[model samples]
Target: MRIEMTTLAEQPVAGVHICFFTDSLEPSGLGVHLLNLMRWLNPARYEMSLVCPDTPGGRWLMERAACVGAVVHPLTVRDRRDQASIDRLYHILTSERVTIFHSQVGISWEGMLGLRIAHRAGVPVRVVTEHLPYLLTHPGQVAEHRETTRLAHRIITVSEGARRTFLERGYPAAQFICIHNGVELPPERPLGEAARVRQELGVRPGAPLLLTVARMTWQKGHSTLLAAAHKVVARYPQACLAWVGDGPERPQLEAGARALGLAGHIRFLGQRDDVPALLGAADLFVLPSRFEGHPLAVLEALASGLPVVGTRVCGLEEAVADGETGLLVAPDRPDELAAAILELAGNSELRRRMGQAGREQVAARFTARAMARATMQLYESLLCEALGRTDGE
Candidate 1:
């Protein structure tokens, strides 16, 4: 399965063929980032492909890749160490003569398997982006993660916090790079769009509409938000809490919301494609995660011109300005979270000012174009070094 290295001239006429490896094609922060990369990367310089499990859940991602003219190769990998799965991946990488293998590490074990297969198949460059800094909290993962870092040509992290965490776990600091996630600046929603979203959510005019777009999970601190929602409802009876994504924690979260007497005020919208429109219709945005890897949702929220109230954690700390764009309170502190939410919810003038500042912040530093350019530069440098090519040569 070893692939012969090609000289720069012998490379694909289209460009370097890079395969982005993932476990599923579900709509995730990483998936959205890849979709953005596919759209923004220069097609003349790079031929993009996505390698993922061919599950029913991944159909959405396959359709998205097809839309952008990127190739999609789906293989069923039931186990991380499945030899058949590795064989399939090996065949694809070798047959396509993949120049670079880039993987997003949702699960370290699966990512490590992909790297091993790519190495065996003679892929010249292998890269992995670690999205979760806290995955190393388990003592067992330290050795495996350290090995994965060693296997990669370069390890990319989405936040400084994540980089530091990995370095502390014995991964080489020189091998790590922090690349912040970015979001596309969406256009202003039509006036009717906002009104329609509010109407569909059963939110009346002038009511404080608090929006949070996150999976229903413990790490996301839905319970903390639920507790804060109770306090919010007691203060602003007309206020409503709308959740935008779904996960395994739905039933428990729903039960908790009901137990806290917030069933009437909280609405779980599951997953929706109209996040921008929903953000436009909302008064404020909140992210109660215990930790994060530079969430794009915060950037998207800022792009939609909404003030955010996020937990004081890694990615959120970087994205939110304490008193400028929004407020950041201690994680899992319901009272503090509620106080901040109430502060933003009670004052329309503060929300307007913070929202404007947030929009300006996103415009200045968090566009998809900036992220794409930085990533492309990294890719070119790595490729050049590997192929013994110099600038303009």
Candidate 2:
């Protein structure tokens, strides 16, 4: 049952080559987000291809990309600046007959090389998705984007904030399009397993379990969350917080937890594939990210029926509805963050209501199907302009 229907032969999306040039796909997040979108894109209407650099996690992407059943090509692009990698990418575009390139990464040298190859291949359209906030810390990214934006036809950003930044940074105002990250709904099954999942994870019954799945990075606001956790523990000692993913900040965050006397209450789960299970066990989902380009983990939490508490950052604004689906506090404010989290943690009825509301919101607006359809329509529009079938230009 498709919403917007177009026949396979009439719209025949065979020659479309979508290249995913990234450092890796397994450290997860954006790569997985792109994979989910590609997997959901209707094969009858679009053909997908991926191109990622050789990294520790590249093998995982190759494996997942294969399982998605698409024409997958692996290219070992050297870390951004290597000229040899650029040459190899050019060969791939020519040999594969790639006409459209879609990059879910930013303006790295590797990404630049891919775009160069696409331009050389006479690829009518090149679309780059901005997955990070570039206005503040990454001014180089904003500049690189401006330098490359002229070569590409359009820029696809996950948040209006990112788009606004690009416009502010001298990128062509007309070339940006905002496409929010979406989630695929969880399987329809009994939620009773949540109790078992929580038990195995060592979370006591009726004890507030605040869950956050993210890399321990500054952008994710781990520092603020850590500070807030101290406040939550001070008030509700039985309440616990879980960090599902690990990163460079893990040791520092662990130190903070210990210093704050939250040794027994906070658990670092590291990296795990059982996110759905974790979401099931969680009472409240929190993402105090300083900024985002639409967080996939938070979307999954909402899809899994968990109440949320997040900051008012780029992609987060589109995720948590203020005082409705969840709470939104000012970025970097641990006091405000702690208050919101504690409020939800203390109120079981509010948690359930918000979680239900979140589920309904995602079901209606953000879904894998909806994202795929919208992306495919853009692809068709670009292809039509190339084929001279419609006046897309």
Judging by TM-score against the true structure, name the best candidate: 1
lDDT of 2 by residue, 1-393 (tens): 111211222333445666656644343677777777888887665566777755556666767887887666667554456667666776666556666778766323336546655666566667777776554446775466557657777778776777786677666788878777788899854668788877877878888888999988777898998888878988787877888987889999998888888878888999788888888888989999887877888888889889889999877888888888999999999999999998998888998999999999989988878887777788777678666676544
Clashing pairs in 1: none
Candidate with best lDDT: 1
RMSD of candidate 2 to the truth, in angstroms, is 6.0
Q: Lowest lDDT 10-mer window, candidate 2?
A: 1-10
How accurate locally, in lDDT, is each candidate? Answer: 0.82, 0.75
TM-score of 1: 0.94
TM-score for model 2? 0.90
Give stretches of model 2 more than 4 Å off: 1-14, 24-27, 76-81, 106-110, 136-143, 189-191, 391-393
- Estimated TM-score for each candidate: 0.94, 0.90
